[model samples]
Target: MFSGNGHGKLVGSTQVDELGVLESPVVLTATLSVFRAADALLSWLMERRPDGVSFNPLVGETNDGHLSDIRRRPITEDHVLAAVAQASDGPPAEGCVGAGAGTTALGFKAGIGTSSRTVRTAGRTGTVGALVQSNFGGVLTVLGVPMPADELVPAADRTEPPGNSCMIVVATDLPVDARQLGRLARRAVFAMARVGASFSSTSGDYAIAFTTSDQPPIPDGEIDPVFAAVLDAVEEALLNSLFTAVTTTGVGGRTSHAVPHRAVIERLTAAGRLPAPPLIPESPSETRLRTTPARDEPGS
Candidate 1:
């Protein structure tokens, strides 16, 4: 786990830092509901554990008070358990879901975003995946190009305070130990700056990386590709969070608007950063002819 700023509560981080292992599924929730969520996670884990054993429930959080009734502590044991039970493999739903439902970032409605990249090193192929709950403040930048001032949200609409927090979770299929994972986590946190994270004093910026591979840890010399993958995947994930979120009306009628996609595309295209759209097939027959696979002759 790498923490760029420690302004928010993150339960079980000290243990993960010391022992370099996460023994439970991570539970993410609002700031005030963190303890309750942790307790629920612990209860759910205990039901299946052997007697006389200790466990640590890994729960992380970001404040969502601006958009939700956070002080009410809406998260409950059932909510945590349902999340654990419904977890499955494959692409996860992103943007305005789960822990990110009430979050915002870079003056736009932000939420859960995820992305993955493939890496090859030491004659072995691996994958790196990142999922981020983006809720921070900064000027939005894309592909090193800043969005135009006129494209930004009007000043009157920017009601949310300057800083909140972002929680990044990185997973990999590579053979790496906790030490290496920590390095990967650091790269994830660093990638935040690529998309214009302020890293403010009041913001909690953290990344927790873990590997699922059972093989022995790879040598540090072969870790460079994995590090590069982390940067690319995380940067894209942050952008995805903003791109996929929809405008949301929150507590006291406060609103966070979604980033303007069409205008952004136009800006990037004008800046020569985005390519023009490819020409479409003229008709269905032409499209079929182009897409159809070739068949083998009778005897070849």
Candidate 2:
């Protein structure tokens, strides 16, 4: 596996950078619980690879102090193991859960959001999936249209926490090496920019992308499709995080509110940006010559 860490206090980042490989499960948690989370991950990995003494437990984080009692360091070994044990391919829980439980994005109650895209290249189809912990600040945009933040979110309701951060994890089924994966990760940052993130000096936007396929890496020239897919998926995923979140009140009674869905849809529709609805198929007519039985002509 391959991985990356950006501006946050991301543990094990240097190792991943030096070796270009991920040797353990990536655990995401609040800044205060990075050590406990890492210990738990290391303990879990040791059970599987008993001889591995130098394995780097990859754990990442974004500051959630404003909305979470981070000083309490609530994440424990049990919580970490429970997450690893229950991992599955079913639909993921998004918006205000796990590491995203106390996150905000673009001045909204943002959390976990995920999206995927299928790309075809050289007669092969691959899927690129993005899961983002949306805990950063910026002007909110949906599908390239900017939202008037001041009008939509008054100063009183805005609860953008300090030390803004976003963690983007990308998974693909295409065969790509560390170098190519790094390129893909950079494109994810571009996706963030499209959604109106400024990549502020401290926002700490990071992306980690890995491929599941074992085929030889596709040449650099053929990677455009994958890059485009990553961009589209990351943008949609960020928007989804905001759309699915509910207004939440957390530490110090600070509150973050979810974006209004109906209003966004209306705006998009008014802007002529919504795609056409799918058309339903009509049944064939019984009188169609191909399906109708001819008179008993030649048989008689």
Local accuracy of candidate 1 as per-residue lDDT tens digits, 1-300: 999999998999999999998889988888988999999989987897868378889999888777877766767788889889999997988877788888889888888999999999977898999999999988889988886323555642667877999999999999999999999999999999999888999999989999999899889999999999999999999999888777776666776777777667666787899886463222111111011112331100
Judged by TM-score, which candidate is best? 1
Which residue window of length 10 is worst by lDDT in model 2? 284-293
Judge candidate 2 against the unseen true structure and give its global Cα lDDT, from 0 to 1.
0.75
Among the numbered candidates, top lDDT falls to: 1
Model 1 worst lDDT run, 10 consecutive residues: 284-293
Off by over 4 Å in 2: 1-6, 275-300
> Candidate 1, which segments miss by more than 4 Å at Cα?
148-150, 278-300
Give the alpha-carbon lDDT of every model.
0.83, 0.75
| Model 1 residue 253 distance off true place after TM-score fit, in angstroms | 0.4
